[model samples]
Target: MKLDESLFTVPGVRRGLRFYVTGPTPCPYLPDQFERKAFTHLSQAAPDALHHQLSEAGFRRSQSVAYRPACPNCNACRSVRVDAQSFSPSRNQLRVLSRNSDLIRRPVEPRATREQYRLLKHYLVNRHEGGGMSDMGFREYAGMVNETPVQTALFEYRQGPEEDSPLVAVSLTDILRDGFSMVYTFFDTRQPKRSLGTYMILDHIRNAESYGLPHVYLGYWIKQSPKMAYKKRFQPLEVLDGPVWRRLEEDE
Candidate 1:
């Protein structure tokens, strides 16, 4: 398939890109299922424009690769993003904001640090014991944070505004031309009551609004995946349905 250049205000449309599909792997978020991905490397002269177009096309970036689910028989993995301009927090969500009000958000460079790596290990051990990234080491962690080809930002959430405040959470995000894609986030599990995960998502929406961006890409959400159901809490969401994006209905 070829990308339509008529739909953009940007030039340097990439051409002749190659895409491949991986062999089926056990579905991580669902049971008795398998998954595949149609992916292409983020190799081009204009990486930012290419990244933006692919993201609008429902592809997500990992390192230098852009991919989306291509499970031939199953399309449960739907790409979803929040309409940052129209998002309004629920009562519970507001409480989450209040709880983390003391946490200061600091945007840092993409380079990784030992402090962040140690925090990642603690988060993984408590929250995702046997998941795919449970065994990730510092080297791999650094690569994940630093090997990006496009613009990226790492938000360090601390207990205070001071540079030396206790770090409690970290969000590695992709800054697309039109919005921010939350690539990954990890936090202090010891303060679960702070609802750090929910707080981060809310903060991203707030961040998008402040930047005058339209959306906060939240990656894929599956109706049957309990792990992803929380994404629905963010209203005014748009989901990529095939080649079109439309407002997600309440019943959907």
Candidate 2:
């Protein structure tokens, strides 16, 4: 696709940064609607700084590309992040943390492993069958983990305190200047009650706090999408509105 030259006219974006719009595709979050995206490549000239600026404007990074929803007449996708310092886990969330206390979290380099791919495949088959990434092979999985322009790591959650414990869940995370961005996460489907998905977010919040980061970017929160509704469980959530990020009210 040809770059949209006019996009560079936006203030604060470097002169050479090119942007493009994707063709309409079926909306993954909403039924019977289509979706489009405005995206740009993250170049090495100043990748981290560029990523920080774009992320503050609600753009999300996937590999080396930064993108945001550009679908016409659809504004359901709202970028959200948790205020790590002020965030306090609810009683229920604390219980989830307690339940998963035995799980060990290991931060590994952004390289794919067979064990991780195997767990990913199992997760896709059970939780996301027929979805966009359900058909991904090990090679594609490797590309997803390894192809990044910014600092990234894999947080592997294992079943025990042992170093070689069975892998239960994994989170692909990006280390931002101000916070941690959770790119993607998948877990074993056998233990539904464990709520490993929620636990992972909680863990990231803790991790960010330990690193003295201010926020934990949870990606988009779609009001009508049940799959994304869980993001609201984290209190003091902030949502980017236009060029400003505001605290999300309880009723909102």
Candidate 3:
């Protein structure tokens, strides 16, 4: 395992390099243990290549964000992606996709708004109250939505252009040279019928195809977590196993 020495010269606040290790901390996905990460600056010189390689190897990019596991013994986090060329929505997925047809998606600068924050707050309280981000305040939310170095945008989902207060969902996505990475998404869970989560991914897949990109990098998929199982529904998918992304048979 060779660390890319080039990573040292990667872009960002160039006030000389500094590296530090985290104390053993509980793993987010798995119970009762710790996780650590070795991070570096994300440079524009070779962002696409670096992002592709790092993401393929289980790293997740936040806003200009890039991070990977450096834990002592844990290896549960695995990167996942949807094969845009081969993806075929199931009957249920198609239904969800169709349900969202009334919504208009607009690509806007990646900045937080009052309405968006309101939806995010609702989502957190209803869906993730006991989770870590449950209490994120305005400034924190701003950083999550605003800080970045790569090409990123916010997809606003509204019912109709003329309808006031129509915003129903929002997604933060990175427009990579090769494909797109869905950084985060939050929606009005009150409108569960729309299945906003599924809708966003489907939209990204369609967006990828329009750009001639071949894959949509989904952050991770853990078999045991019901939260992540939905990812498998987007069939003709690939999971990062070791150093390669092995394509799984539809039934496998």
- Clashing pairs for model 2 are none
Per-residue lDDT tens digits for candidate 2, residues 1-252, read 344443344456666677888899999989999988889998668898888888887889988999988776778899999999999999999999999998999999999999999999999999999999999999999999999989889999998878789999999998889999999999999998889999999999998999899999999999999998899999999998876789999888
lDDT tens digits, residues 41-101, model 3? 5656666566665655566776665776666565566677888977888899889888888
Top TM-score model: 2
Task: Look at candidate 2 and tell me the lDDT of residue 109.
Answer: 97
Better by TM-score, candidate 2 or 1: 2
Cα TM-score of candidate 3:
0.86
* Ten-residue stretch with the least lDDT total in model 3: 4-13
Q: How many backbone clashes can be found in candidate 2? A: 0
Model 2 segments beyond 4 Å from truth?
1-11
Which residue pairs clash in candidate 3? Answer: 25-34
Q: What would the C-alpha RMSD of candidate 1 be, to one decimal place? A: 3.7
lDDT of 2 at 123: 96
Cα RMSD of all models vs. native, in order, equals: 3.7, 2.4, 4.3
> Which clashing pairs does model 1 show?
none
* Comparison by TM-score, 1 against 3, better one: 1
Sort the candidates on lDDT, descending order. 2, 1, 3
